[model samples]
Target: MTWLVTGGAGYIGSHVVRAFEDVGLDVVVIDDLSSGHREFVPGAVPFVHGDLLDTGLVEGTIREHGVTGVVHVAGFKYAGVSVSRPLHTYEQNVTATVSLLRAMAANDVDKLVFSSSAAVYGTPRTDLVTEDSPVAPESPYGESKLVGEWLLRDMQRAAGLQYTALRYFNVVGSGTPELCDTSPHNLFPLVISALVEGRTPTINGDDYDTPDGTCVRDYVHVSDLAVSHVAAARRLAAGEPLAPVYNLGSGTGLSVREIMDAMVRGTGIDFQPEVRARRPGDPDRIVASGGLAAQDLDWAMRHTVDQMVRSAWEARRASRD
Candidate 1:
């Protein structure tokens, strides 16, 4: 059965596409290349360079390829930028999802795996977050994602659609050097890029309540996250009962200082990180528990912090060359 992977040429989406390939599942991709690189998609996989807002295109691709399911990874994911560009974020992340849901229903493709984000939790009061955590999204991007999940829930009732949303924390690392995270807003790439460019990495606000005076966050390897996506898609395709949402995260998290240290070890960069004023909306910590995902989706942290940093560093270095 063929599955359509929306935005499959992006960083994490590329890894998800590879995961499905590794399992011998045929797949197709439709990405506008807004933030995704067209070259990241394998030549053998059919690639449609288009946005999800075009319901007709989505439906056409699904019908042409005989798509049986979808792994929805396309969206506007910059939480900070979404604050100033709320409408764009909602249109990309929310309106497009409505179009996708409509296309799926028309094609009778009832199964889906949604790529959700930890931002949906906003600044959680609890040290460890779960699927049941309150969703008080602080940015338009997050609000849009939460809304996407709601659409899936309602679609389930309206059309008997089966779906699952994986709300993962900071996705890092690379399955291969060609598939590194290229987001300018992501922390791993920012640090690795700084060191590569002969600049000292900076840490914002060291006076946070967390130990080590830095924000703590769960960082899951991108490859491991992809595995869970594939598992969720498989479960949905099989009509197995699944939760509407699952957190793909490391229950325990790393402080900003710890991540900086890992970068030092990973890249052999010796300069001390510059401490700066904390950015607005920065929280002391936001770590989600992946207990539920582990039980159902075969989710696990297959790589260590050092492995994560080293792989990302290597991949970023490779891209520059």
Candidate 2:
């Protein structure tokens, strides 16, 4: 009854690991420690430091632990980087997933919960996207995830593998007081770092066609997202029929300027942000319906924008303490 959490040492993965452990489940973590920290895994859980692309290692770990399911969270996630490093992104996200699939097949690990992203939607023709929305990924990162879902669907059709791919939108905030996102790619931490370091948080574009003239995204707290994964895993273990996809996000949208306002108010810091041009592949606005996750997983985001800000601020403060 153990679950293997790939990239469990990462910001989001660590949170999911904590959530699973809190529910009294046996958890084993496999991380390459490339971007993830080894210290993030709880001392109580067994941690394996390795690459998921290694079929032998992946199968061996699953077989050794009697793992029944895997939460595939490892890979390159930065949308901007994925554009520049398309080959590397493909190798990490797509190739690695294929290798993982092979390993799961060999080990008889029939269930998986994949961490997909809203980037798969690209610049939507509309503001709100549903699970059935047309996937026009602008960058390689999104393409890789969409491809992963495709692979999972095919594999499920051929094999008996059951899976649920959760397409996340703007995962922000901290789950616990100890685990804050240290990644430089995310908008929340990037802004917080800039402000904390006495520099301006750079705004990508000021002239977007949305309110506040900046990009708008749905921000889901990390804890709520983690809880959704837990629920998805439990439901799959209960022999629930697999739908193969769900969007884990809040239906509400928040503009970049609105997030900045929340960060300032939550941290009691008033700092001006530098206006800049738009990044190459950024969508003007990407909000989700999240109706599928709400109905299927029975999950809802409880934390507001202010709560996200406060949690990140507290984690940052704790880091410095």
Candidate 3:
């Protein structure tokens, strides 16, 4: 049975596609190329160019590819941007998800692994976010992801749709140099691009209540996150009972200054990052406990912070124009 990966050409989705390839699983990809690069998809894999909002296109791809399961990864993913473009955010993340679910039901495709976000928890009150943490999304983007999860929950009860949602924390690093994170809003890219262009890196704030006075976050490598996606898909395909949701994160925290130090070692740049005012809505610290994912989805911290910095640096350098 072929597994269809929506948005399989984007940074994270592309890595998920490679994980499926490494396991010798037959897979098909459907991406609109909005923020994804078509070249990221391998030529051997069947690629469908279209949007998930088009139910007909999605249903046709499922039928043409004989898809039995899906990994839903496409969405309008910028949290801050969603604050201003609420309508656009909901349309892309919520409505598009509804369209996808409808297509899945029409085609009798029941098994799915959804790509949720830690933003569903917003700024957690606790030190470590767990699967049971209260969901309080602060942005339209986060709200959209939460709605997608609810849709999955409703469908499961209504139509017995077999599914699991993985709420990912900060996803960084790269599995290959060819597949690099290119989003302008991400930290790794911002620093790497500055270093590449011979500009000094800047930190947003340094007066947080954390140990280093900078925002602390759980950073997991993209490759590690991708493996868990594969594991979740395998469990669903095998009809093994799995949790409805899992947190894909490192059960630890890293301050921005600590990451800067890592960048120095990883990129060999001997410059201090300029301090700036904190961006509004920036949380003090938000790390998650990956114990649940580790126990069930083959999740592990396969890369260190320095390794994350180095991999991102190298990939950025390689993909420079």
Candidate 4:
């Protein structure tokens, strides 16, 4: 079955598109290019440069491409910035999702794989989050994502929409040199860009109660995350059952200090990260159990911390040249 991948020109979306191709599945792309690069999409793939807000364009693309499934990845993804730009975030994430769902229903595209976020958990009381963990989204971005999932559930009851939302934590590294993370607010890009420019990467806080006195997070390689997305799509296409949500996490986590060390080793840059005061609402640690995903979606942490850093550095460096 053919799939329409929204935001397919973005870093993670590009990788997910490639994964679908690697599995010999027919795929098409729909991206607005606001935060995506047209160059990331292959020359051969049919690309529709448009936004999900335009319901007609979205429905037309699905019908023209014979898309039976959709990988919904396009949205406002910045969590910290969403606090200030709540309306913009809701418009992009929540409203866009509703529009896309309407288009899918109108076109009889019943299958979907939603790219959700671990932000829905906010600052979980427990370190290891499970699929059943309470969802208390702290930012507009997260809240929008939760609403997107709700819409899918409601659609399932109303229109027989078969869907699965993969909640991801800190996604980093690169699947290819042509597609590297360009998010201004992501930690890896921020740190790597600083080092590339001969500046010290500053840690947000160093006095947390973690092993290295810094916040701990689940950092997964982009390629690994993409694999799970494809698996989810395949399961849905094959008419197999899937959980409502799955956490694509590392189970364990790494501290910021640990990542800094990996970056030093990966880039051969000998420097200490400058420690700064904790950002407001920063959690000490947030990791999740990927056991459910591992069973159904073929989820696994295939890259080590060093590998993650090295791949990301290579791609970032190549982008500069």
Residue-pair clashes per candidate, as listed? 0, 0, 0, 0
lDDT of 3 by residue, 1-321 (tens): 799999999999999999999999989999999999999999999999999999999999999889999999999899998999999999999999999999999999999999999999998999999999999999899999999999999999999999999998788999999999999899889888888888999999999999889999998999999999999999999999999999998889799999889999998888899999999988898999999989999999999998999899888878874
Q: In lDDT terms, how accurate is model 4?
A: 0.95
Q: Which candidate is the best by TM-score?
A: 4
Model 2 ranges with Cα > 4 A deviation: none
Model 1 spans with C-alpha error above 4 angstroms:
none
Model 2 clashing-pair count: 0
How far is each candidate from the true structure, as Cα RMSD in Å?
A: 0.8, 1.2, 0.9, 0.6
List where candidate 3 sits over 4 angstroms from the true fold.
none
Candidate 4 global TM-score: 0.99
Q: What is the per-residue lDDT of model 1 for residues 1-321, given as tens digits with 9 covering 90 to 100?
A: 999999999998899999999999999999999999998999999999998999999999999999999999999999999999999999999999999999999989999999999999999989999888899999899999999999999999999999999998799999998878889999998998888788888999899998899999999999999999999988887878899999998999999999999998998878789999999888898999999999999999999999999999889888887
- Residue-level lDDT of model 2, residues 71-179, one tens digit each, is 9999899888888999999999999999999999988888999999888888888778888888899889999999999999989999978899999878889977788
C-alpha-based local distance difference test score of model 2: 0.89
Kindly provide the TM-score of model 3 when superposed on the true structure, using C-alpha atoms. Answer: 0.99
Whole-model lDDT per candidate: 0.93, 0.89, 0.93, 0.95
TM-scores for every predicted model: 0.99, 0.97, 0.99, 0.99
- Of 2 and 3, the candidate ahead on TM-score is 3
**Residue runs of model 4 more than 4 Å from their true location after superposition:** none
* lDDT of each residue in 1-321, candidate 4, tens digit only: 899999999999999999999989989999999999999998888999999999999999998989999999999999989999999999999999999999999999999999999999989989899999999999999999999999999999999999999998899999888889999999899999999888999999888989889999999999999999999999999999999999999999999999999999999999999998899889899999999999999999999999999999999998998
